[model samples]
Target: MATDDSVHPEARGLEVVIRTAPMPADANGNGDIFGGWILSHMDIAAGVLAAKRAQGRVATVAIDAMTFLKPVYIGDLLSIYGEVVGVGRTSIKVRLETWVERQRRRDGSLTARQSMRVTEGTFVMVAIDEEGRPRVVPEA
Candidate 1:
């Protein structure tokens, strides 16, 4: 999981693939949601894109430059987006971004922004053959 070291705004060319609300059980002692949960969502988003491009099975081989910008809380809506930035013979690099929309406070005032990017990372996915091993990726 990436550390909450820095943050940035959303950009274009990224595909939004996952969105869900955080539950109470998904949080830690600090009441902040876990980072792994967010990362898993991002992986799922990347996997969907990778599988489509690979035209078959694919597995994550590496993750590069993961950075978490903010902490998510319960009742917040989580959204993840990813895009295939690079493609190799058997691997693809997906740039992913995660965001959250927290519910407003009781006073009706804006408790949080509409969409806050929590984390971003580059996930490498390898195209796999029927035997479940790495295989050549088709030309795009």
Candidate 2:
């Protein structure tokens, strides 16, 4: 067997944690959804899942480089899914994938929702106690 480098090679599976729509308020000056908005939602999704796995409170410690495959726009139904790629003593690494079902208007009529990959990222969350100290993750 070969040693695994930085990121783990295996992923348990992905589950949809959040489904939301980007509003006009979330749009950036370019008229597209702001990357920060999407990132914030992804972090929330990660925290929800991490807290459940940790059986308590958790905090986001790190995020790997993010790559946006497509742009997100208003009226798009965004779906955020996460998978547990790795679990350490006090940390749970989650991989988040964002897909969007976009609504496009053509000739003054709304088109069918088309789903496409928008962006993805990896977040490192640590289980914490009431005092905000790192704690061990409970076995599932």
Candidate 3:
């Protein structure tokens, strides 16, 4: 698994693909956002990029090298960043990173406003036709 340290600050400015706040229902028993919930968001973000690259529908075929560096709170604003790292005849590999901008405290304190990287993974998506058959990725 790739660690957060593998991500550099300069390269972290990739376009944000998905940004949303997690609800209490998405939290685990420990009051932190569930890992599966984060994975779902990552898939959605990666799919968005994949579809754009494939210029059509795409489906996730695999998730590789996922690493969770920190826990996400329910109130945190989750931001997923993705980019097409590789492309094949019918497959697109997207590198995705999840970050969180924690919500303010009840006391209205202005502290802890910095965003933190929580998780990251590479998603392999394949272009598909209407009948769900693999299609060739168009040349860019």
TM-scores, all models, native as reference? 0.85, 0.85, 0.87
lDDT of 3 by residue, 12-75 (tens): 5677898899988998777778899999989999999999999999999999779898888867
Model 1 Cα lDDT, one tens digit per residue, 66-134 = 888888877777888777889998999988878877666433456646666778899999999989889
* Superposed model 3: Cα runs more than 4 Å off: 1-13, 103-110
Residue 116, candidate 2: C-alpha displacement in angstroms? 0.6
lDDT of 2: 0.82
Spell out the clash pairs found in candidate 1: none
Task: Give the number of the best model, judged by lDDT.
Answer: 3
- Please identify model 1 stretches exceeding 4 Å from their true place: 1-11, 105-113
Ranking by TM-score: 3, 2, 1
Encode model 2's per-residue lDDT on 67-133: one tens digit a residue. Answer: 7878888788898888777899999988888888777852225887677768888899999999999
User: Best-fitting candidate, measured by TM-score?
Assistant: 3
Whichever of 1 and 2 has more lDDT, that candidate is 2
In order, how many clashes per candidate?
0, 0, 0
- lDDT for model 3 comes to 0.85
Model 1, C-alpha of 34: deviation from truth (Å): 0.9
**Model 2 CA deviation exceeding 4 Å by range:** 1-13, 105-109
- Residue 124, candidate 3: Cα error in Å is 0.3
